[model samples]
Target: MNGEDAIRAVDSLFASVKNADIRQKLGKPHTNAGEILPAGVDSLINSIGDIDDQDIFLDVGCGLGNVLVQFALQTLVSKCYGIEVREEVLIHGLQLMDETPSLRDYCGKVAIVCAEASTIQLAFERPYLTSKRQGLSQ
Candidate 1:
């Protein structure tokens, strides 16, 4: 999709999600919300080098799922997770993946949750331990 088309797609996706009731039910709006620019996303992903199928990428507080979507489309990572406190936003992200043909490749690869980041217990499937322990000299 071109710039206009992408914008239109995003706009339509947002239009389709009616978060009014969800927001009202919450009683207060989320304060931790924002999206990384496409350029920044690109740079960040590119710097990550290669992504294996077993590797899972996690984005905390992923608003609108922009970063997750970008990562799924731009990289070969088969699994991606986004922890979002808002349900409607995650729904909107899923809706976007369904609507955009370019994102078809990532259908079952993306997962978004409506929960706090700190509440998540699993850090990584396999803990990546460093030789030198923090605050302890070897």
Candidate 2:
């Protein structure tokens, strides 16, 4: 499924969305998440402009998980994972993947974790980083 198939799929998924709220610590700035248009996602990935599928993608606050899904489905990355603290939002994303068999096909390659980012161990022992890929953030 190359071409603009992944983008079209994501656009379809978001078209059926509703409002959702996320909890934040008291007094802290209200954390707001924005939806990037499918074409914008394509442009962001295109800006990265990787020549090969060697990048490992990780979206810290992956609200609806469109970026990770698109990355994996579009063949832009070798592996993709999203860390979302909200269980309901994460469930909503998983349901999208379940409804679409093509997205489900990459279940092994895509992961969505419902947990606070603080709980995750970012300091990995493996050599996932390189001079070319200095950091993993999107």
TM per prediction? 0.67, 0.76
RMSD of each: 5.6, 4.5
**Predictions in order: lDDT:** 0.64, 0.72
User: Over 4 Å off in model 2, which ranges?
Assistant: 1-3, 20-29, 125-138
For residues 52-129, write the lDDT of model 2, one tens digit per residue: 566778889887788887787676577888998877778877777778765576655678898889889966665554
TM-score top scorer: 2
Measured with C-alpha atoms, the lDDT of residue 90 in candidate 2 is: 81
lDDT of 1 by residue, 1-138 (tens): 233443444444345444452343555755664455666777686676666665678888886676676666666777888888877767767777788775576546778888988898865643444423245443
